[model samples]
Target: MPTHPHSPAKESVVDLLGMLAYGELVAFDRQSIDARLAPDLRRRAQLSIMAAAEMRNYQRLVARITELGADPQEAMEPFVQVIDGFHDSTAPRNWLESLVKVYVGDGIADDFFREVATLLDPVDRDLALEVLHNDDHSEFAIAEIKAAIADNPAVTNRLALWARRLVGEALSQAQRVAAEHDSLTMLIVEGTGDLAKVGELIKRLMQAHSERMTTVGLNN
Candidate 1:
């Protein structure tokens, strides 16, 4: 087998990296907005910290894009519609729902990224891993969800429905992202395939998400 140099991916690689960076940036923005829905200052701050991490990660991705001769904004432009749409359509109806979306949505996305990261070169792989939420931030969201449920048992039904809606919107957005963002999707396709691997990857994401939801006392 011929060993290829780790030159920048053709346009495909460039576009994929751009989409991932933009996705991180938008995720930060949306989470910051949704964080305000938190009931108190502490929880809000925790979410803000998570968003800040994303911005830092975005900077790193942009720097890498520049290194590869791509403009960061140009790299990110193609993904605005699908990313923005998912957040817009899935806007939480309340504090608990917002938490569910943050914890639940972010959890699945991170898992997907972990899978994708493995397929990248060391630098890109490390970048993908670095973009994930820290354990403490995740714990904060989880703790808040548990506390909210504990404090108001009546909220379980409402929050469960809201959680379901968030997942549905998230899955829809993922499909759109996959269809529109070829480079990242190609990474998956290369690792898995057109059919079975993609389905299985999504299944793992869904399963992991379901387990997380259950851990927080939400129904699937």
Candidate 2:
């Protein structure tokens, strides 16, 4: 029997899936830890629930990777360093900072997933859309951040700067991912056949981020 030719594009797809899976896994872990910083039982439980949701999403991604005949662990190993670095550098010091990190970091990740979903094949695209944050959990974060700002007003400046740093760190890691994964880079560029479309996608993510910041009373 003749062996089937492998699609080079599949390499990018697997890489993308692996990265997302690891992200969901780490997100679950970080959110669980951050929940401990919650000031009260109700808030801590809410954060725990949010963290559980990420774990469920992580399982889904892992199953999908397995379905695609890839070892999830091996696939995710490449991303461990950069992803760990992102979380370590952005570790939140307080409950309010934790909320801001969730709001900013997860929001950007969702926006990036949305942008990439357009370039994926049907199976992968659907999976990407499914794994992206549903926005329900974020309501709590948004509410908390807004309430904190209302209470102090001074923390707004601090969190606004924190949000900017989150974006900066995320972008730095993104550039590293792009440089290391050419096939994934090609997927984004070929999505519209114009390099400028990639720039537009990034601008859209930033625009959405700014709106989210303003929604929570934080200056962008």
Q: TM-score winner among the candidates?
A: 2
Q: In terms of lDDT, which candidate is strongest? A: 2
- State the TM-score for model 2: 0.94
Model 1: colliding residue pairs = none
TM-score of each: 0.89, 0.94
| lDDT, candidate 1, 43-101, per-residue tens | 78877888888888788888888987889899888888887888888887777777778
lDDT of 2 by residue, 1-220 (tens): 3122222276677888899889989998999999999999999999889889888888888898899888999989999999999999999999998899999978988888888887777777788888877677789899999889889998999999999999999989989988987877887787756789888898999999999998998864
RMSD of each: 2.4, 2.9
lDDT of 1 at 139: 87
**Collision count for each candidate, in order:** 0, 0
Whole-model Cα lDDT of every candidate shown, in order = 0.78, 0.86
Model 1 error, position 34 (Å): 2.6
